[model samples]
Target: MRCCLARRRAANSPQKTQVSLPEMKEQLSQLIQQALDALAADGRLPEATQPTIVIERTRDASHGDLASNVALTLAKAAGYKPRDLAGMICDALPASPLVSRTEVAGPGFINFFLSGDSSRAVVQRVLTEGEQFGRSNAGAGRRVQVEFVSANPTGPLHVGHGRGAAVGDSICRLLSATGWSVASEFYYNDAGAQISNLALSVQARCRGLGPDDAQWPEDGYRGDYIADVATAYLAGEKIDATDRHVAGKADPDDLDAIRDFAVAYLRREQDLDLKAFAVHFDRYFLESSLYESGEVEATVARLVANGHTYEQDGALWLRTTAFGDDKDRVMRKREGGYTYFLPDVAYHFNKWQRGFERVINEQGADHHSTVTRVRAGLQALQADIPQGWPDYVLHQMVTVMRDGSEVKLSKRAGSYVTLRDLIDEVGCDATRYFLVARAPSSQLTFDIDLALSQSNDNPVYYIQYAHARACSVRAKLAEQGWDWEQARGIAALPRLEEEQEKALIKRLDQYPEVVAGAALASEPHTVANYLRELAAEFHSYYNAHKLLVDDGELRDARIALSEAVRQVVANGLWLLGVNAPEAM
Candidate 1:
């Protein structure tokens, strides 16, 4: 008995048994192809062509586990009606224990039904894999850099930054989960007009000039936080940031000193807000570094040498129109200062040189106009960068709501709702979830009350409660002097044949596919939606069934199922940078 148990343990180990939904789909496709080959061999159809076999999960349970339209795709080439071809393909399918039966449905759709054992195998796989269950190697160790929340260090991080933080970090997590070597970057525009404006704003405040004062720069920032910076600067406060440290000179006339101090100070503020939001960057890329290193000049030289640039009105302009732009864009202003487009090209070229085959820039929709210009600039460089060299994920605006009205201003940030405010009020977990649960392309409306709610009406809480409830069941079982044993649970999974149990198992089986799809499509919202659906299935099953029944086998099976759900919920929440609480 001891030897037999040891053999079973060895067989169930993660390294020994690695089954995934994608692998299952591939196996089904291979089986279908074999069937098609046999049909061609027997002269029932023309020789099989090299058609791509696509397998998708059936939406309706009555159909089967997986459905393929390979027959429909190849029927015309095979000179047979689609429905007739599907029937022949089904008849030619090789016998397999994994597939209990095959059926031909509408328009040459071949559906394969898995045996009960095959369907139930996912439970064992989940238990064995634990947190690693849904992860995949689709990315194959490709290097990708996700630059986001690259907010200029002019002020604190506002709610818009919060949205980018949530989405960008989640993208990194999803990519990492799918075997992509992802670098999370926060690019800071430390040397630009924005910094100059910030310094002027501080200087005016230090000189006792308000926004209404004629001395104040036009359209200057007027937030109360500007006064705080002015006070700190006049007091000669020292500031330290990720890239630089500076001490204020207490000289309001020293505009350069104020510029350095304000940039460092606001960078620190943005850092704090990010810390509170539970987001961190692998690197803090300073835009000033590009200029300091002469990359901007080199990039312009490349553009000019490639004949994509010309002199116009005492300024150098890139023939952006050549690369599909509406018109040419100025590369360098007549004042010898390069336009923002130059530095952007330099930064992306820097990213490309860093050996990132894939680079995703997550920014607000307001930066949409720059996308065309930047890509055109890269193409002009003749670096052989793809037409769409660095991909972009532009998120729309986020509006914060409280008391049934839009709350738009933050004293800390000067003009918008601060990210720290949301984190402080609604908490890091709820704030991240609310920000990321929707598609980034859609404008998000963050309702403060909705995020703060502790009940099921809140999606985050609802999903977390499912995990906690599962934990509670195990705690209760332990309190009664019983513990879950993997051997017994595996032995008893066959007893889980109830409708709700089957439904829960089916939902759990979809997680790996969901993770791969979300990662490949760069859509973390898919995982968020999948988690909610999984939670709903678990909740329904919990409400309809008793986990600790009189039947020992059934009880063990149910507990195993609940444990799988809890594990998955925890994994899914972790992907979104949200914690899964044991009790909430």
Candidate 2:
């Protein structure tokens, strides 16, 4: 079967500070629609048989700037051969200022060649838009809540958590860039068995007991950070976190005191680590608050009242199977304590009550099982919440490499590599870029040696170096006692007839579309990949031609192009939470 190509639409609302460039692909789609409409008006084609118009960029420049397969898709229904239908569609098309001409390509494909003026207009658009070049109001002020890096305060953030932070923050940035009212949240699992173990571990350490001790609490934490927490508790140190603050009682024998101090201490540590990594959360929702505020009990009561629960062998079982689970899940165990997923349902229920139309959770893959249970529990509530009301972006594990070997453990975080180690060693820019340079669904191997490299071999460096090169051109222009006027540069746009200049201009025109696509798809890596290609194009152009030429008009035009490249690179890097250095 022949595949149908999908059409692209330009964003409707553009910011006042930015000039919105028309999407050439969308313009072609509209022209195709007009042709179909004209055919329908003449009764040559049925008015009711409307096919989706698809316009795509051509693989080879000779084909055209854009191409469409609508003719091929509608040939059978239109009662015509493929190429003949293509000819009819082309013949019916109306004239447009953007598209210079159209052609019937192989197998009934319609190719569109963009006018030279239309293709080169993106440089001026880039300069006019400045920092707001790629931003669009695609979401129309919709509310979205992004919950990410929701780690328990039991320990410091590991590399896995680092990946979550980087990806989640970038997702929030993308959503904001697309004009979504985004709220970032971090869920704190500060209750349940994990906290119990953490308390016991701190208590053991406060008593001068080590992990190797026979009397050390069972299933206790073995990390040396536990010892640090214990020492802080004994010293009466004041600990402050975003949501709470506590002071150590300096009493080792008090387990409750130790637990409170330790939780606060570690939370503060995690906050510092995230701050260093340039990740921030609007709110810290604690799991313990669900029980403290009676939300968990209210959820359970509602579940029972709604006939979705039953007492089975001294335990309350939820009918998750009624919704989608393979088997029923226990809501409350025989001992009367609730399961982990119960509070999750309550938390998400709270999220719904807060008027968030869309909620996306960025979590580790380990939470895969909880996804179904949480959704099923929400369904069982019968709250009119959609079955898939909340969305998820689960990132796979990250493997850190050093000297061609897997680096598994950290001195601070006993069981896994700490996020801080990576940030401190490779710097935040490289760390953020590497963490988010790939699809979150795919496993990532972060090579420390590669990240630290300063050559073209490193993607982050290469992209940043391109921005720096553009900045250098401007500096050199100033150094040569040449004042560039925007009016002059814009007028000189006609002089940009070189192949390299045309390629760069075309690529610059696609930035807004790329931003919109990546934002809607929740794939920041798409922006990352685009930046690398864009940087390569700029670097190649810089190598082939001289920006500071003796010819006045050509020099201004080239400088204008360089400035556009710099602006776009800066804008793209800002979306990914990486720095676009003026000098690298």
Q: Model 1, stretches more than 4 Å misplaced?
A: 1-18, 74-84, 106-108
Q: Which residue segments of model 2 deviate by more than 4 Å?
A: 1-26, 37-49
TM-score of each: 0.94, 0.94
Model 2, CA-based lDDT: 0.88
Among all windows of 10 consecutive residues in model 1, the one with the lowest summed lDDT is: 10-19
Give RMSD (Å) of candidate 1 vs. truth: 2.6
Error of 2 at 300 (Å): 1.0
lDDT by residue (515-561, candidate 2, tens digit) is 99998888999999999999999999999999899998789889889
